[model samples]
Target: MTIEARFRIDRGSFTLDVSLSIPARGVTSLLGPSGCGKTTLLRAIAGLERCHDGLLKVGGVIWQDGRRFLAPHQRPLGYVFQEVSLFDHLTVVRNLEYGIKRVPKSEHRVSLNRAIELLGIGHLLERAPGTLSGGERQRVAIARAVAVSPRLLLMDEPLAALDPSRKQEILPYIRSLHQELEIPVIFVSHAPDEVARLANHLVLLEAGRVVATGDIQTMLTRLDMPLAHDSDAAAIIEAVVTGHDENYHLTHLDFSGGRMTVTGNAMRTGDRVRLQIAARDVSLTLERQSDTSILNIFPATVDAIIDEGSAQVTVRLLAGDVPLLSRITKKSAAELGLEPGKPVYAQAKSVALLT
Candidate 1:
């Protein structure tokens, strides 16, 4: 097993009982609300927070058990928290070297240059962490982690501290790590968009318990889970660029439907892509509209009607049973007289291309 962690810890009123086995490769997100024990669970797996009952292992290497527990320093882990937490006095190079030097040369599977290159921090190596921007410092922090050549990487909302612009700047670097690096990463975040974009697998926690775990798409679409009830809840559809309108700068996607035209992206013909359309983005119509500006319309039939609250209803749609969710107000549903066997055209206001 790549990662094996079973935690049952109690501290006063807070109790966290979770058992999870994550794959060794790709990104797996630990998602939950604040104080839901995500950070505590990360700490426990890292051996930073001692648990009365725990069994943690990475790469089939036992790090913690009821009888034996490995210390934090002993575990080959690359940890990057929200704070940059670099040595203010030390130059970026030295900060990276600090951990790289700790592990013997024979054990250094990752080179110092490689870490800097991976983080795109080659220029900032001579500067102090204090002189760097928030994103720059965070990149250095990540470089320092990778320099250790850890068996597993654990990050706790590493982008939480950065501003939106900084987050965008660093997201691609994180993506590269997932695409190129060998080590598996376990990241904790509460943001749905982040999970949707970054995580290949998801471990959803609620009240300090493992509520659900699955691929990102399945977790988002499963009606049994609360994720399906989210305002942003929808589906990821893989599509290919079938054609483009030269005059309008519009690209068409071919999925089950012959075409879908979205606003952005200069997609070349035949380039495969993923699109994210929010449930709220979809508006159901009984027949295809010829008068509207909406370019993308799909034939769908209602599968289930879940009343989300007094005002809103969640409709599970089937484009030939390819599940897509649409959120409409309860009043609107009643006005439209929507129900099972209702054939409608799902109109999307926007479709986000997943890069």
Candidate 2:
């Protein structure tokens, strides 16, 4: 299933004109800089912002068109704003119940208990909203939204209001929603780390227009996109835990490209994990080095190369079917004669394991 949206909103100097078909599964992130109309586009999808030439369809069901328009209340969607707007008079469970009461009993796909379990908020159910911490309050807010059992979930920078520590405390609960619920999520954020960790699909907006849209892995590594040139540019790799070295206390993960050994024992065998490899941490070699400190070395074919500045160049490589990025000095690239389809070996100095 897919969500089709077309909207044109003009206000003085700013205009939002976009047409997109977003995947109706997993988390689809709306990523851009500030004042780029990410929130405006999300509001249009939720029926909160009405446009004369707007058309919206979710899973083939028309919500807005020229003939008719569904009001915000009529749409079956749960929205989580940056601020936790729970009623001060209501308890955590009561806030959740308020949302549950709006939905028909017959249409409740997610039970109250399941929502509580998903957010890990069972202990805070009886506590009032004012008594909870920022992270706790956001958890209750999210559980309330899930209790509605809507077909779609829309989050507008749900962690933007929280501090760094509070944001860290609540990210695991948000991650669980993707793993446990079937509802499609539209997440809005400017933070690349959050998008990298949570998003399965990516939609890049620029000056109120859709600049690019694709799977997160492909979009992040594309040289033409702004993501690859960012200071913290990195590649996302999906890998599975193959085994563990008991004596070395290291875990081994395998992807389509090759195997990687990480310095950790937290991940278990047969578990799925995400690996983040920064471009600066990877170096290219003409031949596979047998006597090297880098444990993660794989043969890769150079796909493309772009000069970052006068001193350095960024090289795109394909290890089997997986794509990787490596940043090296221009002099080194020239000496190695790197170009498209050239066989080389990529050495990863460090790898971050994210789950």
Candidate 3:
């Protein structure tokens, strides 16, 4: 199953003309700067915007075409906006019931109880939205959306309204939803950290067009893209918890390329996880260093290099099939004679685990 979308819209000085095929499952993040048409594109997919000559096909359903257009209510989707938008007069359960009641019993796939459990909001069911914390309110809002058993979930900066602590509180629930549900999700956000944490697929927008769209790991590390040149540039690595060293308080993660040890995580053995390795934290050496304090070191082959600025260069490297990025000064790169196919040792100073 896939989503094939083609849209063209013009509003005053801004115009959006883009086409792409998105996967039917997992989270696809529509990422870009402000006013880059991320929200506009999502609205087009949700059938809330009237885009000219648009063609939208989700799974096997034709949402919009030349002759026919499905209304927002007709589409089997649940939308979570930046605002909670909960019914002030209703309890959490009632607000959830409001969403599920819109669909007939014959179409119910996700049970209300399961939705509540998934979002970790069962305890807040009897409370009013005003009484709950920001994170709790957002979790409740997410549960309400899932209660309807949507074919697609559209989240437009669902965490934007929350503070850092609130965001941290609600992120796990969002991650669990992606893992447990079969529904496709299109999330819009300007936060790189949020995208790195949640997205398996990425669609990058610039101005009003899609600049790039691909797997998150590849997209983030692509040397040609602006992400690779940014100070926050990093590589997203998918790994599994192989074991833990109780003595050192460290956990071993094994990916397709190699293994790395991170500070002890709460995950159990065989649990799949994602790791974010910032380019700035990685340094390349011609040979493996034995006196280093870094625990995560891998033998990598240089793939390509791109100049970030007058003094720094971003080098793309490959550890087996996995791609990584290293940002170093021009002097270091020149001294090491870094080039494509050169064998080197990559030392990672820090690795962040994202479930």
Pick the TM-score winner.
2
Decoy 1 TM-score against native = 0.87
Instruction: Estimate every model's Cα lDDT from 0 to 1.
Output: 0.86, 0.92, 0.92
1 versus 2: better lDDT goes to: 2
Ranked by TM-score, the better of candidates 1 and 2 is: 2
lDDT of 2 by residue, 73-124 (tens): 9999999887878989888888999989999999999999999988888999
Task: Mark the regions of model 2 whose C-alpha exceeds 4 Å error after superposition.
Answer: none
The TM-score measured for candidate 2 stands at 0.98
* Cα lDDT tens digits for candidate 3, 249-272: 989989988999999757899999
lDDT of 1 by residue, 164-257 (tens): 8898888778767757777788899998877777887899998899998887767777778899998779777768998888788888888874
User: What is the lDDT for 11 in model 1?
Assistant: 82
Q: Which ten residues in a row have the lowest lDDT in candidate 2?
A: 170-179
RMSD of each: 2.8, 1.0, 1.2
